[model samples]
Target chain A: MARCRALVRPALVEAVGRLHPWTGEMAAYALGWADPAGTPDPTGSEGKGVRQALALLGAEAVGADGAEAVPGAVAVELVHTFSLLHDDIMDADALRRQRPAVWKEYGTGPAVLAGDALLAQAVAVLAEAPGRHTGAAVRRLCGTLNDLVSGQAEDLRFEDRPWHGPGAVSPDQYRSMAEHKTGALLGCALALGAVLGGAPDRTVTALDRAGRHLGLAFQAVDDVLGIWGDPAVTGKPVHADLRRGKKTYPVLVALAGGGEVAHELVTLLSSGRPVDGEAAELVAALVEEAGGRAATRDEARRHLDAARRVLRETPLEPTAARRLDALFAHLLDRTW
Target chain B: MARCRALVRPALVEAVGRLHPWTGEMAAYALGWADPAGTPDPTGSEGKGVRQALALLGAEAVGADGAEAVPGAVAVELVHTFSLLHDDIMDADALRRQRPAVWKEYGTGPAVLAGDALLAQAVAVLAEAPGRHTGAAVRRLCGTLNDLVSGQAEDLRFEDRPWHGPGAVSPDQYRSMAEHKTGALLGCALALGAVLGGAPDRTVTALDRAGRHLGLAFQAVDDVLGIWGDPAVTGKPVHADLRRGKKTYPVLVALAGGGEVAHELVTLLSSGRPVDGEAAELVAALVEEAGGRAATRDEARRHLDAARRVLRETPLEPTAARRLDALFAHLLDRTW
Candidate 1:
């Protein structure tokens, strides 16, 4: 992951700099490459570069040097950052990565424009990418964007529905949303890398499937952390999902079971008041008592196992397989 | 322009429908093709399709059937509508084409998502276009987007400065902004059409120059209409720009003249009170008396002449030249 990030960061910065001056500066700040005033920030924190890592790994799996996938890596990362910027505004999130969110640091209008510029830049990067497969790569990226937009629209609509009524979210619906929101781009990253590496269509499809499963596992673990991880480490408040009454996988799973604790949890959450600290603690305890935590953990493990099996069945070199396995372990085991 | 709109409307509708369900519906509504409930509205108003006309005209100028540029036409129109959607939100305008704007009818969140989807789909349509020049066409579209973003950023930034202070907008600055915000896409339309029609680089460049000047003339006329046109014809209140304290080209020109009437006008506008019926009429009289109105009209005429000269110098077929001339006259002569 670190190697892939090192290779793609400079190109990503160059691509972003191609935007109009004000937009470019705001986009750079959102990507952690610069301060709010457009000065370079050498010590700024960066994202995990998960999509870039997946792109490189997919390329390597097809017996190509990962350098061929640098454009795809940069394109996916820009799209990811674009989503984050707009999502922060839509969600009205105040903080990100332990700092003020883009919409908070800049005004909402500028932040929206910055995100708009980044989105355009993402497509532009792929369109100008130097490769024989550039056309197919852009189509795949567009498909991913469609899924991302659909997923986000669904998520926002979900927020307006009753938690336990006819329109209430179900676990399957949650998984589907997760696939569209998180899994689609991850899948596209691998597919783009494979296509750029001149892999067979079958191998590319296999890599895409593996990526989707990996994305599911990633989001499952994130959901767990959102509920129980140390706030100091995660940069989010403990039981954050519960406090916000977010209908995450665990909460949906517990709600489906309809046990006494599940009913109590639902009653407390659906009251339409801000969940105080004590209510959050009690809700978390009730969710755990209803087997939600263990169920979610099991789901993550299942996805990780499935992803590993898919990769093993693919015709990847032994070294590539080993590297992918190591990275998977690292991602799932990370404390932060 | 009506002919071009008729030719591109189906393709544009199909392209917008390629987005996710919710986003596609909102985009359709924004484009004035459907109602908020996703029902088709036969009487819905549409844009002038100026960019589409330029693309088709450019194609014809190069001796290709105008149909060859339909994809480019559709792409540019989608981008134009995308900009309109976002700009409406940023400007907080409640109406467009005398109807409730997309953001006003559907809310800002969905409108933003719809715009993002349209932008991606614009590039996607070109990438999947069935022609040898698809790659180059996509690149040109991206470059145009860069200019559009920059133009919008400058326009927004200009709003932050005082109207009569040192940072007040200048006529040259307004022209530069219009060039980016309006001219770039128009230039791109012609370039994309020329490229698709297999025109040489020199001819493409000339067409682009012609398109840019045409765009400038269009905007100049628009600025003039914003202040002096009848509300019944323009679909906006009389002197709408002055009422909003917008530093339009004529206003900037009047400010730069620094006459006694201009000084009084500035003081009245800068007082921060809303310009009512009497004030709007007074400001209009002052601007006209200061020669701002005449100057702006002259500027538009000059640009129209320049655009015509550039088109004439290009080695266009005789019939194509006649058609271009007719369209140019129609655009400048429109009352609304």
Candidate 2:
């Protein structure tokens, strides 16, 4: 992951430099080049580097040097930054990566422009990539954007629905939204990496499929961690998703099966009573009692197992395939 | 123009449908397909159709059927809409095309998403175009976006600079900004159209060059109308730009000469006193007396003539060339 991130940083930095000076500074901050006070960070590192690692690993899997996929890595990361900036505004999120959100720090208008600048640069980087399949690559990335829009819209719609009963979001609906929202981007990264690595269409498609499985696994783990993970690891308060009344996977699973604990859980949640930290703990216990925690873990393992199987089945460079398997396992067991 | 707009509308509508329903609805309203209350417009006709016309006309100029450029035309138009939606948010403008601006009507968050939707669709349309030069075409549009970022950045920077001082925006800087802010889109329209229509590289470049000249002329005329054009025709209050302390072309020219009238105008402007309608009118008179109006007109005329000469010199379909000439002349004389 560090090696792949190292490969991505210089290219990412140069692409961001193309922005207007003020926006460049803001983009730098959002990407962790600068702090909230506009002071440049010496480390200049930001983000989980998941997509960048996936892209490089994907290229390596296809028997190409990871460096060959830099354009894809850079493009996807820029797009990722663009989406996060806009999403933070839409979500009214005050903090990102332990600092004020771009919109909160730079004002909404400039944040919007800064996001736009990153998105435009994303297109430029991919479109200008020196490859026979550059056009196809850009189109693939754009199709991911389409899925992103759909997922975000569906997520927003879910917010308006009741947490339980008639208008509740089904487990199927939640999964589909997660696939579109988060899965599509991970798939895009792998697919773009393979294509840029000169893999055949089938290879690219298979990698994309594996990536989507990982994406689902990733989200499922996050859902579990949101309720029960250590705050030191997740960087969020305990039961943060529950406190916000978020319709996460565990909660949905817990509610879908009707029993005494499920009934009590729904009542406590739907009571509209203020939920303090102790109440949140009780809700978590109730969900776990309803088999929510176990079910969510099983779902995550199911996806991770399926993704690992795909990696084994698909034709890939031997060493890279082993590394990818290990990487997927590491991600599944991620403490942070 | 109507024919070109007709060709674009169906495809444009279809492309917008690809977005999430919420964003799609907002985008429809932005493109004049829906009313503010979410009622769909019966006609579905919207926007100035200038970019669409330029694109199709560019194809005709390159000896191809205008239909060949539909993707390019639609792409550029989407980009134009994207820029306007974001610009309204940045400028905090309340009205657009005789209605509440998208940001004003839908709130900035949804507006930003809507704008982002259009831009992503713009890239998708061009990237998916069926042509040998699809990559180049998308690159051109993305490069135009780069120019747009630079232009908007400069425009915002100009706002922060003193009206008259060491950091004052010069006419040259203003022209450069206008070219990036506005001209880049026009050039992209023509270049993409010609490229997709199978024009040679030289022909595409020439058309892009001519389109940029028209862009400069377009901004110069808009600057003129911002101060002196009849508000009844322009749909703005008299001297609206002056009242807002905009450092427009005419004002820059007026102040550059440092004459007595210029002195009075600067004194009036720098007093930090609120400029009501009467004061704005006084400022306008002083600008006119200082030759600002004449100089601006001459600047516009110079660009128009240069564009006309380029059109004449370039190899193009004769009848299409004549029509383009007439179109350019009409634009130069537009009342709004």
On lDDT, the candidate that comes out on top is 2
Local error of candidate 1 at residue A302 (angstroms):
1.9
**Tens digits of lDDT, candidate 1, B234-309:** 9899898888777788888988899797898889878888886998888889888888899999889999999899
Whole-model lDDT, model 1: 0.85
DockQ class, candidate 1: medium
Best by TM-score: 2
RMSD of 1: 2.3
TM-score of each: 0.94, 0.95
lDDT of each: 0.85, 0.87
In the range B110-132, model 2's lDDT, one tens digit per residue, is 88888888899989988888868
Q: RMSD (Cα, Å) of candidate 2?
A: 2.2
In CAPRI terms, model 2 is classed as medium
Per-residue lDDT tens digits for candidate 2, residues A1-336, read 988888889998889887888888889899888886668887634787889888888999999989889999999898889989988998788888778899999888889899999999998998888868787789899999888777777887787788778899988999999998888999899999999899999999999988889999999999999999998878778898888888899999999998888889889988998655899999999899898899988889998998899999999999999998998898888762
* TM-score for chain A as predicted in candidate 2: 0.96
